[model samples]
Target: MPWEKQFDIDEVLEKAMTAFWHRGYTATSMQDLVECTGVNRASLYATYGGKRDLFIAALKAYDESGRQALFAKLEALDDPKEAIHRLFWPMRPWHPGLVSCVAVS
Candidate 1:
């Protein structure tokens, strides 16, 4: 039988994305990814290729999730102006808790 993954890939990618978002790609090391993801380096490599590949995956995941959420919110609103306004000015402030967007830092 094929080796089974012990952890949730989505959860691991979310953690990895958060780590990269906070520390940036250059500052975040494999060890940091390992710790943040709670997955061993070997497993991460085997599952996601290398750090670069993992970063790309994380970025894609972020973009897809953001788009889905935006669509859902926009679809719920009847007024185009309200949708545009809400898109530009969210109800809540951007912070770690909200994970509003991908930060350069």
Candidate 2:
């Protein structure tokens, strides 16, 4: 039955990564990951060796992706101040996306 369970690891990782990134480690439940990734609990446990391991992997993946994106912008801008400004410029928009993760401040 091993071959029958042909789930894509990358897709699952990406889904899990988004869930973790959005909700953070302390708030994200195992059920949340299962729902987000569209995989059963057992499959998730077996594939990634529980929530912590999966979260670690997902964080690494996300960090690598963010680093690459920042590197590209830095290369294009050349100026450190401009690069920093460019990196944070997109976040200045009044989007509801960051509201969920923001604490009362």
Candidate 3:
């Protein structure tokens, strides 16, 4: 039979995603994931199949979140240039932080 735990998978993944997003895959340790997700190491390993797999999942989640956020922001604006600027400009300063999660190797 399947068992249930205190952790919410989506919520945990969201946090893990953010952590991996802010810190690169090679930089984020299992301890970091436990601390960020409030879930233990065993759970992380069992569910995500170690750090690499978890990071890949997190990166996918982060990318989906980014695309959704961008779509929403772009849809809200009437001017295409302004929308593009708003979506892309803030990236310059935080590019490293946001783009680092995409590393799956």
Candidate 4:
């Protein structure tokens, strides 16, 4: 039988992304990914190939999420200026916190 993954891939990627976001790709180790994602080293390797692959996946996921959020905001708002403003300045009071763009960083 094929092996089944015991953890959520999305959750793991999110955690891994957070780890990379805070520490950066060079600074974050496989051990850190395991600790942050609650996944074993072997599993992470098997699932994501390696740290670079995992980082790419995480970055893609982050970008997709940001795009979706931006589209949702744009769709909901009637004013184009408000949508543009929100996109440019994400740290507005309504937002929970600042999320620096991970793709650029």
Model 4: per-residue Cα lDDT over 1-105, one tens digit each: 979999999999899999999999999999999999999999999999999999999999999999898799788999988876777675556545755545435
Candidate 1 local lDDT, 55-80, one digit each (tens): 99999999999999998989899998
Arrange candidates by lDDT, descending: 4, 1, 2, 3
Q: What is the C-alpha lDDT profile of model 3 across 1-105, one tens digit per residue? A: 876777888788889888877887779999999999999999888899999888788778778988999799799999988986776667568665564334422
TM values, all candidates: 0.75, 0.60, 0.62, 0.75
lDDT of 2 by residue, 7-95 (tens): 78878889998898899988999999989999999988887799999998887877888899888868897688887677666775856
| Model 2 TM-score, 2 decimals | 0.60
The residue ranges of model 4 lying beyond 4 angstroms of the native Cα positions read 79-105
Please list the residue runs of candidate 2 whose C-alpha ends up more than 4 Å from where it truly belongs after superposition.
Answer: 1-5, 77-105
Residue 41 lDDT in model 2?
95
Segments of candidate 1 deviating more than 4 angstroms: 80-105
Report lDDT (Cα) of residue 50, candidate 1.
87
TM-score of 1: 0.75
26, model 1: CA deviation in Å? 1.0
